[model samples]
Target: MNAHHDHTGPHGASPSGDALPTGTTGFTDEPQITLRGPAELADALPYTLGFHPTDSVVLLALHGERGRFGGRLRLGIPRSPREWAPVAEQLAECLVEGCERRGSRPDGIVVFLCQDPGEGESGRRVMERLRPFAQKLRTACGALDVPVYEALCLSGGRFWSYCCPDSDCCPPDGTALAPPGTSVMAAAAAYAGIHVRGSLRDMEARLRPRTARATVIGQERALDAASAALVHRILDTRARKDVRDDTIRLARMLVDRLAEHPPLADQDTSDTRDDALITHEEAAELIVGLQDRRTRDRAAEWMEGPEADHALRLWRALARRCVGAYGEHAAAPLTLAGWVAWSTADEPSARVALGLALEADPEYVFARLLHQACNEQLDPETLRECLRGEREARAQAGTRHAPGTRATARAAGARGVRRRLRARVGRSRGTAQGAPSTGPGSARPAEASGPGVGAHTGRRTGRQEPCGTRDGGPGGDPSGAGGADGSEEGSAR
Candidate 1:
C-alpha cells in the first residue's frame, strides 16, 4: 500500500517521507543537496532505511548549523532512492542519534517508511531503509540472545505493543485488527488502523513545501523506467479471459509512431521471455523488485522447481487469460478428452509455460488471475457466499500465500458458521419426508419425489396431511392425509 510518511505537520498527521519534487523551482541556488563525500553513514541512511514495510519505520533527519531544531531538511521518501547514498546516510545518522541519545546504539536505521497506496507499494526509500534494518534487527537480536522473533510474533494478542510506545500510530480508530506474528509489519500497521493513505500520484501533496521541493530531485530517468515497466506489465495482463483488455493494442498504437525505440527491448531481454505470457526470470525479477532478496532468490528457484500442484495452478490461470484474449477467435484442436487443454495455442500455451514457471514459483499474479477468472464466473450471491469462506479458502492455500493471513483470520473468526446452517437444515428436514440441506459441502437429504408412495400434496392442490405428526417425516401422517396436505415443505414449494 502507498501512503506518504505523514507527521505532525498537515491535518494533524505526522509529516514523514522524502520531500516532493519542487516542480519548476526557479533560480536553483541552494547547493543541490549533494552528498559531501564518497559516501558515509549519513549519506546512506535516507536510501537504506526505506526497506521496511510502510509505516513500520519512520525516517526523519534533524539538521541545522546551530541546533535550532531545524536545518534545510529533506525527509527520506520512496523517491529518495535515486540519490540513495546521501539520503540514506542522513537518515541513518538521525536514527543512530535517536537511539544513542537514549543511551543505546541502533542495530540499524531506516530513512523513511510509508504506505504506498496498494500492496507492496511502500515508498522506495522506506523499503531501502528497511532492507538494512531487518538485517540489523535480525543480527542484533540474535547476537544479544534477545529471544529474537518478528515483531508480529510478539505483538500479536497484545495489539497495543509497539517499538515506538511514545509515538502515535495513525489516529486510532478502533482496536488492533491483527495480532503480531510473522507479518509484524502488517500487524503493526493494522494495529495503527492505517489504511493506505493518499494516492500514489497524490502523495506529493502530502509533503510540506520544503520537503515537496525534492520531488524533481534527479530521479526522472529511474522513475521513467520504473513507470514504463510497471504500466506495461499491468496492461499486458489484460489479455486474461473475459477482460476487455485494450491495453496492449492501445499501448502499441500510442507509441508506434514515436521516434523513441522500445527501451525494454534494448535493456535486457534475458529476463523477459516470449511465447509464454509469464516467465520464471520475470517472476523472480518481480519478487526481487517488490520483495526482499531472500524472497526473490527463493521465488526464482521455485519457478523452475518441481511441484505438480503449482504447475496446475499456473496452467489454469494462463488458459483462462488466453481464452479471454482469443475470445471468438480461439481455433485449436481439443484433446482426446474433448476438453480444452491449455498448452495448445500461443496464449494458452503461454499459460502452460506459466504453470510450469509456477511449479517453481506459485505466487505469480498472472497465474493467480486464472483463479480470478473462476471467481468472476460466480453469481453475486454465490460470490458473496464464497467470500464468506474466503478465510478458509486462503488458509487452504497454505503459508506460502502471505495475503491469506487476513483472510484466514477472518475465516477462523467465523468458525462453525456452517453448523448453524446445518441446524436449520435439520429443522427443515424434519418437516419434509426428506428435505434439501443448506449446510456447506453437504448434499440435500431429500429423497426423489416418487409418484407411487404418495400423491403430490403440495399447496398447488392445498391437500397436505390433514393430521398426525407435523410434516411428512416418519412420525407425520402420510401425504394426502392430515397436515401432510399443508406441510411446510409443500407450502414452501
Candidate 2:
C-alpha cells in the first residue's frame, strides 16, 4: 500500500494524439521525455506501481498541463465478466474521488487491463473478451466526468488499443511490447535509479502458506499442543503477567536466533532452511503468544537495523507455520512482517504481507492502517522516527533502574503493587463478570472475563472477540502525507 503520493514529471500524450516528445519541462525542473506509443506506456506500468501487475486493472491519472502523470491506482481484475461493471464503477469512483481529495481532478486516465491468457487461450481472445470490460471502464470514468483517453488491453507479449483506430499505428491485432529494459523510459528510469520490481504475485509467494498435507498436519499438531500448554500459562491468574514478559523475551530471543543465520543464496532454500530452524513448537508458541497485542507491539520495537531483518525473517517463518485452524492467527505476525519490510524499504514484500494479514482478518486495524499507509506510498521514516523516540525513552528508563538507585527500588515496589492489584482485579472479574461459568469440571472458564482470556479455558459459545486494537495514528509522512489518516484501533494491551 504505497499510498504516498509522489510528484514527478514524465512525458505524456492524448489518447489519439502523437507524442509530445519534445522539450517538456516537469515540476522537478527536469526535462521529462514524452511517451511515444503503447509500448512505452506498457513499460512505464511497473515503475508506476513499483511492480509489474498481473491480472490487474490499472489507471494512471494525467494531471495539470502536458497531461503529466499523477496518481495511479491498481486493483485485481474481477474474474467474472458479470462483476466487471461494478468493479469498473468502483475503480473509477475510487481513483476519481481519491484524486479530487488530493486536490487534482485528472484531465484523463490511462486504462490498462493486464491478464495472462489461460490454457488454449490466445492473446487476441483475451483482448476481445476484455474489450467490453474496457468499454465499461471508459463509460464509468466518463460518467464521473473524467474521460479515459487511452484504454489498452495488455496481454501475452503485445498490447491492443481501444482508443487508437489506425491499423498502421495502433493495429487491430495489437502491437508487440518492447524488449525488457530496451525502451527509452527504461533508460530514463535507470539513469534516475528507478527500480521496477518483479510481479506482485512473485513477491507475495514468499509469504503464502505451504499447502503440503504432511507439513500442514505437522504444524497443526504442534500448534494444538502449544496452544494447550501456552494458553494455560498465559491465562493462569498467578502467571499472567509473567506470560506477557516471557512472550516478549522469547520473541526477542528468536529475533536474535534468526539473525545468527544468514540467508541462503537461493530464496527457496533459504526459506526452507529458515523454516526448519524454527521448530514447530517455537513457531506455534510465538504465533499464539503474539495474539496478545502488547506482546506484538513489544516485538515491533525490533523494526530497525539488523534486528529488523531478522524479525522479518522470523515473522515470515511464523506466518508459514500458521496452518489449519490457526490461519487467522497469522494477522499479528504478518502485520509485523509488513511493517518491518516497509521500514526497511522493501515495499513489495510489505504490501504482500499486509495484504495477507488483512485477508486473514479484515478487521485487524493495524493491518488496515499499515496497508493504507503503504498503498499511499507514505514514507516509513515518520514511523521509524516515532519508534526511535520510544526506543530512546525506554533506554533512559532502563538507565534509571540501575541496581544501586533508590528510585529503582521504589519503582520496582510500585510496579509490584500495580501487578498485584491488576491480578486481583482480573481474578474478581473472571469470577463475577457477565461471563457464564460451566460450574463443574469445565476445562476452561466460560468466557474471557475481559481481554486476555484464553480459548483453552472452555468451549466458547460466542463470537471470538478481538484481542485489542492499536491506538495512536501512524505518524505523518514527511513526504507530504498530511491528508493521510491512519485508522485507529483500540490499544491491544
Taking the tens digit of each residue's C-alpha lDDT, what string does model 1 give over 1-493? 1121232111111133233211011112211222211111122221221112222223322221111011011221323234334333333443333333323332321122333333543233333344544344334333532211111111111122112222244222212333222232233334544233222222211110111223223222333443344434433323221111232232223223221322233212311221133332332222112211111111111122133123323223222222211211111101100011221112222222322222222333222222121111111122123223533443565655566565455444332332332232233211111112223212111111111000111111221111112221111222232332211111100
Give stretches of model 2 more than 4 Å off: 1-12, 15-31, 232-238, 389-493
Across 1-493, the per-residue lDDT of candidate 2 in tens digits comes to 0100111222224433334332211112244566655667776677655677777777777764555665566666666677678767767776666566445667777898888898999888999998998999999999988877678888898888887666776667778888889977677667766666677667666776778899999999998997887776654545655666787878888878778899997877899989988887788878888865545656777888888888899998898888888888888889999889877867656766876776676556667566655544445654555445444544655677665454344334232332332232222211111112122111111101110000011112222211112331222111211222211111221
RMSD (CA, Å), each prediction: 27.7, 14.2
lDDT of 1: 0.24
Once fitted onto the true fold, the runs of candidate 1 whose alpha carbons sit more than 4 angstroms away are 1-253, 256-493
Worst 10 residues of 2 by lDDT: 446-455
> Can you give the TM-score per candidate against the true fold?
0.16, 0.75
List lDDT for all candidates, in order: 0.24, 0.62
Clashes of each: 90, 16
